[model samples]
Target: MSDSLCESVDSTNETPSKKTQLEDGSDSLSVIKKAVVVLTRLPEYKISALRPPTPQQFYSEDESHSSSDSDMEWEPEGDSGDSDFSVPDNKQKTGKPTQNDTTKTLPPQTSTNNDSVSEPAPIIISSAFAYCANEITKVRPNLPEEEVKVDMMVLARKRHMRWQRGKIVEIITREDGRLKYKVNFVEKGKSLVSGHHIAFDTTPKLEQLYVGARVVVNCQDETFRPAILAELPSRKNRLRFLVFLDDHIPVYVGLPFLHLVCRPLENVLDDVPDSPHKSFMSRYLRDWPNPHLTQYKAGYILNAELNGVQQRCEVQEVDSSLIHVVFKDNQHKEWIHRGSIRLEHMARFWELRRVQDVSD
Candidate 1:
């Protein structure tokens, strides 16, 4: 009986092997059928050519120009073993570590002073700028030539939505320290009047300058034109100034001759009577954008007003040459140029001030 069972097992093994071979052959046939079916389905009709999308399809006229405006690249002097980061001019929020990157590069002993119980650095910021954070050095570099090193991140305490390159701006010194500078943006090209819409207490820092005043700026066409403000070597070096104009107005000036013109003033709103009073926003008008607005362009009308017998309204508008304004009455909206409008406060014109136009 045992011998008969052994013979049965051997015979069954052959049957299983045959079954496996048959299954593999069936799979091969199935693959061949699928391939044939796919090949037969190739398009019999001619296919139309598809055109590739161009930049004009998605980007607007303004967007294309702005994308190329800042050719200057920016890189942090972060090799000091410090982690530094920058946000786009869009004024977005990020991690605190990035805000304090400038502080991280200090020597161990200097950083220790931060942890030790001591008076906080009296950071004196102007209305236009504020103290963001600090960076501190942590680990000693692992090198055969043992040397002490550190890094730090001093950020803009005052943030702006339209902040761009080449605009002469200023940041105040929070304290007396190395690698820490106030925000002072230098406008190399044409002045930007759009910044007037940006509401702020002030636009630039106005402090008495002497030896060792810091001024950080981005260099033209560098790998990383990171925000850098270093101390002015001396009063002679204090020879740079940023000028902004309101309503496309221009000023012929430079840092070397700063005192000739008005220093940036703080924007502190005066008391407004509860009932109501005349305001620029209500009457503000714009014809075309400042650039397109030429010397004598007609502008749009805004707020309207009326007196007992006389009809009067504040009209706010603008064109290339000037911000067109009109004090309308019962008759019609009368035209007034931007220059005619009295300057409210210098704060609103921080980015608008520019050097006098050499171009006719």
Candidate 2:
């Protein structure tokens, strides 16, 4: 028995192993230890030795507890079993847990918070451009609406192309995309022609190809045969046009529709007098010049007949794409490279009313 537990009631202080004693239970010290344990005070939690007193029992023991009602922490005097800090408030008592942890359990997609939304729903891709077998039937215009396309090329913008056979016309496309088309003009072969460009690879619409914007799209309507550019990543073969080739002149040939800008070189032949072309021009085509080279009906050269007779008359200019030369009597006037002729030629003939001018 421990001397410290001589007056205490707890049994743990006095229980000693039997081995600690000599084999006999007759030791006087062992008897004294048991007596000391029984006399000492026991812990209050030991159910066999003691039990907790009720609040009323405690108050009965001490009158000071009943007088101070505010001394109670969780429960006040008047409000029995009521607590101010307890959970489940009126606003949060609904089926759903309104705590921050519960709100976080909902998926972000279904969140009602507008600020959490990042992007609008994606748009579904529906209609698109499609490649079709070329039709050879020539679609003639009512022939009443004949207009010229100067600044822009309608065929290049729509990614459509046109070709002609003996008596049939063909239309082709380079890519599959949405389109709105109608027959615009018809030639001898009678191909269904529209003022649309042959769309190259997947590209934006004509509305997106704004002015001053660079674009590359394949040529689908240029010919009936399979185009080589259709196999490349960008179907458009590169065509470079400068609004200003040098210090002057605005050009427009680099687009999908490549038209050779042309003007008549007919004049009084001030430089070359008594030239064959200047003397007899009517006998040749006997027609006015075509402003654009591709639209020209025929080609001619000034040649002298055997007896002082001439096939051309004294004219200003003739339509030769590589060289806009005029042989008034018999003299070379002017010429340009096929690459740089669009705006240069257009500025001189159509706009300025001057062709074969060595002065400027």
Judging by lDDT against the true structure, name the best candidate: 2
110-228: candidate 2 lDDT, tens digit per residue: 32334343211111111101111111111121223223222222222212222222211233443774222322322332223333222222333322332222223223334421111
Model 1: worst 10 consecutive residues (lDDT sum): 121-130
Once fitted onto the true fold, the runs of candidate 1 whose alpha carbons sit more than 4 angstroms away are: 1-60, 64-303, 306-360
RMSD of each: 26.3, 38.2
lDDT of each: 0.23, 0.24
What TM-score should be assigned to candidate 1?
A: 0.16
**Candidate 2 deviant stretches above 4 angstroms:** 1-252, 256-324, 330-360
Candidate number achieving the greatest TM-score relative to the actual structure = 1
Q: Tell me each candidate's TM-score.
A: 0.16, 0.14
